[model samples]
Target chain A: MLLYCKDLTKKFGEITAVNRLSFDVKAQEIFGIAGPNGAGKTTLYNLITGVYKGIGEINFDGSEINNLDPHRICHKGIARTFQIPQLATSLSAYHNIKIAAHFGNEKNRVDKKVIDDVIAFNGLRDKQGIVADKLSLIDKKLTMVAAAMATQPKMLMFDEPMAGLSPLEIRHLMDLFKKINEERGLTIVIIEHFMKVLTELADRLMILENGAKLCIGPPLEVTQDKRVIESYLGNCYAESK
Target chain B: MGHGGNLMKIKKDLGVLLAVYGLLALLPIFFHNNMSLMNILIISLIWAVVAGSWDLIMGFAGIFTFGQIAFLVIGGYSSVIFCKLFGISPWFGFLIGGIVAGGAGILVGLPCLKLKGAYVALVTFAVHMILEPFLKSDIGRAIGTGGAQGILTVPPLKIGSYVYNAMEPTPWFYTLLIISFIAFFIIYKVVHSMWGYSFIALRDSELFAQSVGVNAFKYKLIVFGISAALTGMIGGVYANYVGMLSTRILGLDLFLILMVMLVLGGMGRFPGALLGAFITMFISESLRYFDTYRLIIFGLLVMVLVIKMPQGIIGLIFPLGKAGIIERTILHFREKKAKKAEMIT
Candidate 1:
């Protein structure tokens, strides 16, 4: 396993955001996580990326990496994209990617070639000169993805990468995710709301309810689980099929 | 977009910097006989460094600090003290003063790391507020701050046998010109480097910057120190040029005047603060005939300008693309001439 979370738990005042969630992600696998609002999917990503300090241990690539700073976690070969695209709005797309390539790694020297390749890989070549604030929503999301990739991470996490995307853009992004996994041999853990996208793209899926695991298995079997259907998928989803 | 494009931008920016400074350098050749004008020019150069440093941290780095004048005061006091007690040359005192102020900046920046927005501003401003009392207390007197009277006998900067003093404005003017030019050049380089990118990233969103592996706290603290050091060094120079220091230098009036420079220069724009400093000094000096009403008129002018040209003089002169006021006016006239020629034809 490239990522091993053992009984991770986080609480905020009266509410527990993530409760004793244990999961393992194999290297180079596309792992999918689906949960309703307040289900702690993003909170889990935060815990792993060290945006928040949570109880229990998170081991990545054989080293314990719980409660580290976000930058240090990034330097340890993990990068993530936000639910809302966060970018230096006044800067060009190329400059945005250059920031990650310059600081994300441990090396003192930054390779311009790597930044350019990531920009091209994400198909942001034409839009590279345009400032981020002027880019379309899809292009902004692509710029964020390109920045994350430029970090040269072994594992990448996506928080609702398809939230505002149209069906055609969603398809394009899904293909991009698959290419990133297959061509780059990088582990991906995606938190998404679209069950169809998860079923089609993810090798395995984990469903959470109220910050606790509902079920975990292959996407086909987990979608068939009764608990996932009742609490998450709901009767409407079950009946639609 | 690419290395080539970035290189071209750097070259163009450097060209502008050279043009501006070159014009200013030639001023002494014409106005060397006018001692009052030369004094105004020298003072403007000093404030230019202070205002530019403030812009670096506040505008570019997105740190809303009100302690810039406080840093200048610390540098002034420290340099004078070092020169008096330790018997060091005023030249060496400038370096010492910068080191001390930079240290103070880091010390203050530590508590500010966890703070956001107004809280950071409040904490830094508190430093500014507390400085007056500290310099007036017994500890200040014991440390040769001269108590409430302030430092009276600041040593003049000397080069071998030649001394730089107020009576001879020529040497002081040229000396400060070189110093201010170097200071602005450093700021320009920083604004165009990786450090500049990181600052903009953190300023926009600290969370995103951290996710991308930029340590926000480290960068903020470093910028605070750098800005303070530059301001402090210039403060030392100002002390020697004026040949004295006092708590009056910590007055709110001067603080607000410095702020007007930033506001009129277009915050976050490099070399804008430089232009703002010179223009503000000229206007303030020109209004000296109005007596006490000068400040009121100055304040009113700043308000009107701020409302009318929110981007300041530089923004008015060279906005993004070719739509600046001057450009538009020129284009309008050209179009009128073209129509007139067509009618004649």
Candidate 2:
């Protein structure tokens, strides 16, 4: 396992954002987590990446990283992407990746190479110098991916990589995700709402409701589980679809 | 095509920047040795340093702080105090003052790290105003700030044959130029580097910055420390120029004026800060000639610039909207790539 969440729990004052949830994410697996809005998908990502404190052991690559600072965790080679593109609007795409490259690796710290690689990876060479703010939605998403890639992380967690992208853009992103996992040998964990997208890309899947885990297993089984469907919809039906 | 695009960008930006810098070099020669104008240039250059530091946080990093002048007072007063009371050299005193002020700036930045948007501006303003009275007290006065009466005759630091306290005012003008040039260069390098990207990253989206391995709070603290330190250094220069410490009320006022200059010039630009400072100083100084309507005329310029020239003089002089050459070139690539993909598929 590259990343493990053992009975993770988080509360904002009185409102629990993520209930005690346990999951072991294997190395090089594309783990998919699905839930309704406010189901704590983002909160889960935040807890693991050290955005907020949460109860539960988060072990990344055999070490407990629960209390680690975000940059420290990043140093441990775990990275994530926001649901919405959060690019440095005043900077160029190449410059954006260089930020990650600064803390990336001694060998890869050469910004010029890192930037060129990211530009090639995202197919953004021509737009490399463009300010991130001016980028279109798809391009912005690509910049986010490029930045994460620049970190050379062991595992990459994504928060809704397809939120506002059109179907065509989603297809483009899915292909990129596949290439990143297969070619780069990067482990991927993604929290996304689109079931079709999840089923197509994810090696395994988990379902959540109001911060509590509904079910966890292979993509086929989790989606087919009665409680999982119920948690997603309103009620559970006994018969399988 | 890539080569062509790069050449085009160089031509678009570098040529204009060089020309403007050239004009700035010539301005002093034409000022007719007017002491008021020299004073304006010196003050404007100092303001430029402050604005550039502010831009490092505000324009580039998107951390809008308005308490920059607090660092100035801290630097000025701390240096003056250390020099007069502790009998320290003004040279070392400058460094100590800057560090002390930077330390306070870091403390102020701590609360600001948790805040978003305009809250930083509000809290920084609070920091500026809160430090005022304490700076004016008897103990503060006793430390050589001279209370409301102000300090006088602090000997300038000397390096061999050069006594920085030369009375001709040319030395002060040169000092302003040297400091502004050095500070602006540093700012430019910072803004051009990967660290600059980290600043911009946090600025664009603190949330996003977190996702991409950036420790937002720590980065913010670092920026605040550096910005405060630079601001303090500029403050040291300002104090030494006049050889005294003045009222603390000017702290918040200077902070606002810096912001106004940055906004008037172009936020997030290196030369823009310098340009804004010069313009603001020139206009405000030039306004004094009117005597009666000076304040009114000054008020009108602010209004006009704020409304008509939102990006300031840089926007007016340079055809920067056309800097979108990269975007258009990228679009062209997209077209070509699409065609290639079509053929392959």
Candidate 3:
């Protein structure tokens, strides 16, 4: 397994966001997660990357990694993106990528070659000089993904990656993500609102509502589940006919 | 990729800083009123150092600070008491003051690591409230800081042949500028390192910063600690410059001015800090002819900058200054690589 979580749970005051959630993911597979808002989908991603303190055992590459700091988690070869892209507004796109690359690469490990390759891969070459705050929403998304790529993590999580993207921009992002998965063989875990993006990209999918798993299987099985349809995917989602 | 060019670039930067410091050192020789110019230079240097340090956590690290003055007071009074009452040198007292100040900052910053933005601002305000009255009360005043009367005539910052005093503003200014340069050098190297990037990254988003493997809490304390130490030391020297310590008199106006300096220059910007500090000093001095309303005019100047140029007046001219540091990194890399290629081929 690339990543595994067991009995993961989080609570604030009296309310629980993640309730003893557990799941396993395969290496090099694009995993998908779907849920209503506040279903703990993003919270789950936060837990795995060491952002939130939670009651859970999270293991990556067969080693326990629960209490480690976020930097250590990144150092351990896992990286993620937020639902709202958080690029350094003061940094140009290239420098943003370089900043991330510095963390993953040891001293003297990064030079022009490494930075150039990541820049090319993310298709941010032209926008490299643009400060992140000035980028259009879609470019901001690319910058976030580019920064994550700098770490060269074995696995990358995307929380609502398609949020606020235009349809044409969505197609570009979809194509970009597919290329990253197929060409680089990077394991991807994505929490998304755009059903079509997730179904097209993810090999395996999980559905959640109210912080509990409704089902897990291939895209077809998980989306077709009666529990998921009633709880999240509306009955009219697939067939208006 | 060439070593020669990169080495040249470093040497050039160092030379420029040294030249500026050298010119400042000579100002006392030409001035008939060495007293006033000397004080100006020393305080400017001190402000430069504290402001530079302030830029580290507040600018590069992206944590806004208002409690900087509180830390300065902690360094000044705490150490001065050890000297006057127990017969210790203000020198040793300054060290203790720095540690105490830094320790306090770490304590305060640790709690603040969890509460960000405006919340951090509130925490700093609370700290000032706690520190101010404690300094004014009998326990504070009785210790020979003289309560509201303040401490009078402390020995100055001295090393070897150079003695800083009322007539030696030139010497004092040079001393401060040198210290300021050292502080700047350390900060410059730090901001470019891996840890520096982590600070910037964390500033953008804690969740994102964490995901990239930067411990926001630990780094926050590190920045807070360093800022406190630097501010405390500057505070120690600052006490000597006045030759009398009245917490209310020395700190009240300067504290707000420093913030205005920080903001009118740039909030989390580097060169912005320098520009802010320089502008405040220049305008405040130009208004010296205006007397009591000088401060009023200074306040007005800060308002003008904030109103018209929110990123700072400098931001209007050098908006990319914060982001342009990246160009240096790339230029450095290219030069180094070329040097390696030359050696092999």
TM-scores vs. true structure, each candidate: 0.95, 0.87, 0.83
lDDT of 1 by residue, A25-135 (tens): 999999999988999999999999999999998999999999999999999999999999899887788888999999998673588899988988999888888778888
Find the 10 residues in a row with the least total lDDT in model 1 chain B.
B1-10
Judged by DockQ cut-offs, is candidate 3 incorrect, acceptable, medium or high?
Answer: acceptable
Q: Rank the candidates by lDDT, best first.
A: 1, 2, 3
When candidate 1 is compared with the true two-chain complex, its DockQ is 0.61
Per-model interface RMSD values are 1.9, 3.2, 5.6
Q: What DockQ results do all the predictions give, each relative to the true complex?
A: 0.61, 0.41, 0.31
What is the C-alpha local distance difference test score of each model?
A: 0.90, 0.77, 0.76
Q: Hey, what RMSD does candidate 2 come out at?
A: 6.5
Can you tell me which runs of candidate 2 are displaced by over 4 Å? A105-108, A111-114, A233-241, B1-21, B85-93, B156-167, B248-256, B289-307, B318-345
User: How well is each residue in A187-227 modelled by candidate 2, as lDDT tens digits?
Assistant: 99999988878888999998888998888888888877777
Winning candidate number (DockQ): 1
Could you give candidate 1's per-residue lDDT for residues B172-278 as a string of tens digits? 99899999999999999998898988988888878788998998878999899999999999989989999999989898777877888888887887788898998
Q: Please report, as a residue range, the 10-residue window in candidate 1 chain A with the lowest summed lDDT.
A: A105-114
Candidate 3: C-alpha lDDT: 0.76
Instruction: Note each model's CA RMSD in angstroms.
Output: 2.2, 6.5, 7.2
TM-score of chain A of each: 0.98, 0.94, 0.96
Tens-place lDDT per residue, model 3, B116-137, is: 7888988986887777677778
Displacement of the residue B172 alpha carbon in candidate 1, Å: 1.1
